[model samples]
Target: MAVTRQSVEQFDLDLSELHNDSTTVRFYGDYEEFEEPVQRRGKQTAAMRQGHSKDHRPDLKQLLYILTVSEDGGVPVYFTTDDGDKHDDQTHIPTWDLLKELTGRTDFLYIADCKLASSENLAHLHRQKGRFITILPKNRSEPRKMRQLLTDDPDCVSWKTLYEIRDEDGNLEHRFRTPREEEMTKDGYRLIWIHSLVKETTDEASRMKAIGKTTSELSRFRARLRSPRTLMRQRHRVQEEVEAILAKRPVGSFLSVEVIQEEEVTLKQATPGRRSKKTQYTKETKLRFDLSWKIDADALEVAKRSDGIFPLITNDSKLSAEDVLRAYKRQPIIEKRFSQLKTDSCVAPVYLKEVSRIESLLCVYFLALVIQTLIEREIRRAMDSSGIESVPLYPEGRACRRPTTRRLIDALSSLSHHRLQTDDGDTLSLYTQPTSLQSQLIKLMGLRPSSYGRKKN
Candidate 1:
């Protein structure tokens, strides 16, 4: 079952101890797969009104996923689904509401990617007394104007920042809002064009590669020459290939040939005594093979400046520019979480056939992720203490990382060993003491055996 409000409200009680006015919360979403199943348009497929299954590809719809995270890039899965309406934020309103409740705070940055960065989602965030930083969609017609208003114009340079704290009951809580800085951080966004950089980088790299290839060919031509005729043929071939370079297809598609059958083919003068005929087949076929080559150009170069780098849109006021950039980079953490949830967790191969059961399994995996995160955090803590401070027990966000919860729980279960006593009064070892991980978990959970003993009878 999807986690209910009660479950989130319970977590909020524990969360209250950790967060304060200086903290920032975030949320993000990513599309795991671009295409969804599309039903075959055949008359029979349509007439039956049957849906698609995992074994088949049907009318693929978009999966609008939602993830909420702490300031530290720890992701808490919120929602994942293919909304038939193709709506973005509205598709997960309940989940978002549950998140606010889970966080136990109304004023926090609910970071998300471009898709969830819709006007509706922003408005929803505002309506809930929350804030978010999201990369605006370049497709928005007025975004260029927004960018100019924020980054280009003289007035846009007049940016200001302020921090504030508010009293809630007896506790002092931080409430950061850039009602003015919204033009820059939360709402003000500029579309950065990297296409020029990409093109220039590509051109320079191509030129250098061409020069290297020509030099290499010349060296090979000079070295391969055994007789005067071989030298002439190699020289001529090099020049022809060099001239055709510009018009030639990419290296992967470059033409290569060997004459198979040609009656006019000239055999070596020495071979004339042994062979009456040497045939060369002239048949040719165009084939595109996958080839690997490196360009001396910087590997960081992109075909389009905007191809990989994303637009920086924000409304965060208190955070410095460096922090803002770092915050934006945390978007990918959600993606890794989604991937882990679906793959290692095997959430998709949900045994329950019912859709609700599938959703329930999604929730179970999400909780498992939470447990995994806590386990990793504790493991990292131990590793840090043991002087392996720079290392992680398990790679975080590793695509190939297995279900950490299973491994961690198994480790924990194995830690508290128990051995039965013999009947002959020979003492046998009983349960072993809790390991550092178990103790860390106990401390983490604030568990108390004494308190349990005092419970109502």
Candidate 2:
């Protein structure tokens, strides 16, 4: 572990900012066969247990995988396994300390998701003079206050556009923002609210679709109310049915429901047969129920005011809102590492039952991630330095401007070497020459072409 840390440090990659996240690696075997927290060589390690499976496989046992990566091209720097039952919030403190030790510094920025927003984690990092940025939890009072302010009078809160990125067609790709006024309190840290143009558009479209669906459903219910075979005989039943429909759909907030009652009178003859003197007309009153709904324009307006808004909390007052936004944006880099760890590497569904060996196997997987990241980083850097925009790494000679390590490995998968043995115990070796693309990739990666197959004497 020390040697690996030294190697990463030696590369001089950006250690100024680090991102952290966790996921679960599942196993199907009977992990219970081995005693958990078993002592091995005077050291105890936790065995597989059930937790909230990130892979959505709750039936299987798993180990919680905590990983941290540098913001420079998502190169993994630190990783550790935990008992599956542990929560992510509880792991952040230890992870921060481990990263501090690894980097031998305290001024670097630590970024993560909302799990790092807890008072304990934030307070601990602040006490140690370490800086961090993370998403604000919705349950916090500051966000509630902001939403209320925005809903009551949107102009009351001033906002400034932080930055914007555009696509090739001159379309807005994304934009970030923060409130122009100081949103911090004496007890609270710096709070920046971000608005995504894409999210706002999507939210509006989805809201309209849900409202339309609810309207159509209510029309059908109203038709049923007038039907003679309707089962909703009681007024409460009709109201309950309406509530159920609103609950299932996304239109509850913008919709209003009411049950209207009306009386119907019918006349009948006093006797079964018509009689001139003895017959008297009788009037019977029947109660009828109906439903009425309208879009709560006020509530809908309030929801619209807060669409596409997300908040971030940070203690570093020196960093501008854009800097914090950019740092927190790198949080997804760690997520990509988790993705490559699971999908590209196929690290799940372990075949081993022994818990000790499983832990060791995880270490090997971590090493593989490190090696793959190095190769990818090297190739990309070489491409940038040499003014190479794209490479033909895809199927049918398609171009890949930013190639992944998996695709690069697959491109070289067909190269092979053959060895023949004679009856007299003499041997001859033959190697297949690499294709132009393979040779180019090898050169970009600073590897010899002969490294793909047997070397010539």
The candidate scoring highest on lDDT is: 2
Across 145-257, the per-residue lDDT of candidate 1 in tens digits comes to: 55444433324333233333456665534322222333333344422221122334555567556556654553454344333344333334544544454244333222232
Instruction: Flag regions of model 1 displaced more than 4 Å.
Output: 1-65, 73-85, 92-95, 127-129, 142-309, 382-387, 390-457
lDDT of each: 0.43, 0.84
Give candidate 1's error at residue 391 in angstroms.
Answer: 6.1
Backbone clashes in model 2, listed as residue pairs: none
Off by over 4 Å in 2: 29-40, 205-251, 257-298, 450-457
Measured by TM-score, the strongest candidate is 2
Give a tens-digit lDDT track for model 2, residues 322-427.
8888888778877877888889989976888777788889888988998888788889999999999999988899999988899998998888888899999999
